[model samples]
Target: MGHVFGAFTVLVCALFGVVITANGITVDVNDEVSIKSAARIVADGLMNYYHGNESGRIPGVFDGGYYWWESGAAWGSMLDYWFFTGDDTYVEVAKEGMLFQVGTDWDYMPKNQTLSLGNDDQGFWGITAMMAAERNFTNPSSDEPQWLALAQAVFNSIALVWDSQYCSGGVRWQKFVFNNGYDYKNSISNGVLFQLGARLQRYTKNETYGYWAEKVWDWESTIGLIDNTTSYVYDGGSIETNCQVLNKIQWTYNMAVYMAGAAYMYNYTESDTWKTRLDNLINTLDVFLYGNTNVLYEPACEPSASCNVDQQSFKAYISRWMGATIQLAPYTYNTLFPMLTTSALAAIRTCNGGLDGVTCGYTWLTGTYDGKYGLGEQMAALEVLQSQLIPYTVAPYTNDTGGTSIGNPNAGTGVLGSQTSSATSQTKDKAGAWIITCVLSAIAILTSIWMAMDGKGEAKKLQEWIRVESNYA
Candidate 1:
């Protein structure tokens, strides 16, 4: 009887264990599919931007023409696509788009240049161009020198305008003070310079680039242009506060550029401080920017403001930054995956909201509903999905046994089970033991019943003995 009971207990435990393992595996498969779907959405967007013939000249409702900042963001999308796909086709498209910005002359003179060279605009455009140029330079083709020269010319031209006073702390939007010098010391301006400096350092292997990047980073932090308080950084300084104000609120791009630059700087210098900074930034973004909500509101922004309260802008930025961060720090796969996955899913929701070619609420000044599907928004969504999906696409996870089992228990797998597998396994084991114990108790109760049927005195003795043994055990 004892042998039979022991065998039954072991069998039940093992079966229950297998059931728990199977449930976990089912959950993992679901999560992986969700992640893959999210990645696909992002990839589709990227493909659309590269191949879609959407005209770039649509007038924004608030702003009169296509924003140069938006154009720069488009470049970011292309870069993301290239990084994730490792497909030269996306890279080629990115180069062409950047060169188009440089125009036919490729000179810094701004001849026939219709695009705004406002300090902030120039910084954004130049930095993106520099990045494209650096990327092109690494694998020089016929167009490499042209791209480099064009990028350098624009960068130097912007640098030439710096007087170390008005544009002193960093780059201002323009020479004129707009909205109480709010235009001065813009976060985007500093962010771009930070990007440029980091890229330049990598391409040139010169410490000067690092120096400039660090200087801009310091300025951004000290001036509070980037939100110092939030785990995620804000868009730019408030026009009124000279202190960082979250007016247009928290844009994903703002944090993305900061993280991308920080990650790059860490890579270049192998600095733990930068790595920590990058990790914290990513962590904050993942927590705040995700969930079922389609809109991301800047907690600091006045709820009343029309221009600053746009949720699509927030979505746009989130996708942008996630893609960039992934590109910059591929090794931080665990950190980057959730961000990309969540942002991609959110972006899909944004698209479903009929945001296509609709002016985002953030473009308050541009009231006209310019065809809403701009390159920046589209590209951001695409880059995230494409980059994440590429790995799975190139090499499908063939070890996919339908049988439930623990996957590799590692913190960096970026899968949920990877983080909690051990704890979950121990919990299941404990739960199985309790179940087995309960079954044994049931058996004891039945045994006592049988004894009672045979004789009352004997039943009482058997019950007491069973209780004593069970309690001791």
Candidate 2:
């Protein structure tokens, strides 16, 4: 695969006596595009009609059928964008996609969402709806059946897959015990449940959620699915291996889903164990997943063609949940944001014209365009770019506990003001006005210098030149 590299100069700009550093300033000229607009372009390309249906669910391949997991991942990231930035333009589209996936019981089942056969896959849609659940959605679906209830039913389905037969307890990859992948118990399925449990625990103060949270964490921790030594989450253990050996593929989302789970656990329990575990997992990511230029990447398939359709969307959660963890645990801001910011800027630079004609790709490290366009690629890119919206996103949520949230004091409004572009003619007009103001300010300074020189005639000439320049502007 060919690679594309853009020269980036990371800047730590101090505005009004406070230092702002979440997704630091990148000198990549392409960075000037509107983040929201890029997200919309990505959606337009990827969320087209799939399987001859007119739903907003993002397709897996270009003009192709829907993959339950990928579409869920895309919706999750899109809602994250709306939540993270408080921009609701994507809400209607996200609602349609989400609504299409939920079954009659509101569970994400194959009866509704296609190929939603695996427990982990169903868990994805449930977890995606939780984002809506946490917020007060004014839409009809928000109250039609209650988003949290939907999330709970999905949780119920995922919990049904737990088998003590494997390492005392772990979720089967497939729902049925007789299925081919049923013997496989992976991190994502179980980890998402742990995440849901923790979040529900925090939101509802229900000990039942806490119970499940601790149960899954205990099982994963005890079985070494999360390496006790390294804290990196291994893929899964199969019945073929007697659930004794771990896959240890180390996908970015496997680690991140756990990071997010631990973060919610921290918010709910404030337990040092969860904090320590989350910290250790982040350290593991730094060592393993942090790649060229200290940006995020999958070790097995970057700068190469090995990453399959499913593997392409892994980092979206890393960008989403890692940012979420920061909201819940402010102590991690300095350590995590710089790396995340690099990846975010890399994503923005990958867009065709920053905001215009954006088609995001799966690979972030290449020096040239990889030319792969699909729902997975767009969602992965959307995740990183939307992550830049975290500073704004975290502020409102942090207020949940109290007015003062755990983050940079001025981060929310400051960084958000700097990063957001409206993607309209109004923005171009503002740029033009700023340039005119700058030129006028320069002219005024020059006029003052000439007056100090005791040359009235020369000052007049300077005034005429300034007037001519303004007319040209």
Model 2, residue pairs in steric clash: 3-367, 3-368, 4-366, 4-367, 4-368, 5-367
Tens-place lDDT per residue, model 2, 38-94, is 555554545542332445523221245446676777767766766654667757656
TM-score of 2: 0.73
Cα lDDT of model 1 overall?
0.45
Give the alpha-carbon lDDT of every model.
0.45, 0.60
Quote the lDDT for 30 in model 2.
30
Error of 1 at 259 (Å): 1.2
**RMSD in Å for candidate 1, one decimal?**
28.8
Clashes of each: 17, 6
Question: TM per model?
Answer: 0.56, 0.73
lDDT of 1 by residue, 357-399 (tens): 3211121111122224444445544554454453443211111
Deviation in Å, model 1, residue 228 alpha carbon: 5.0
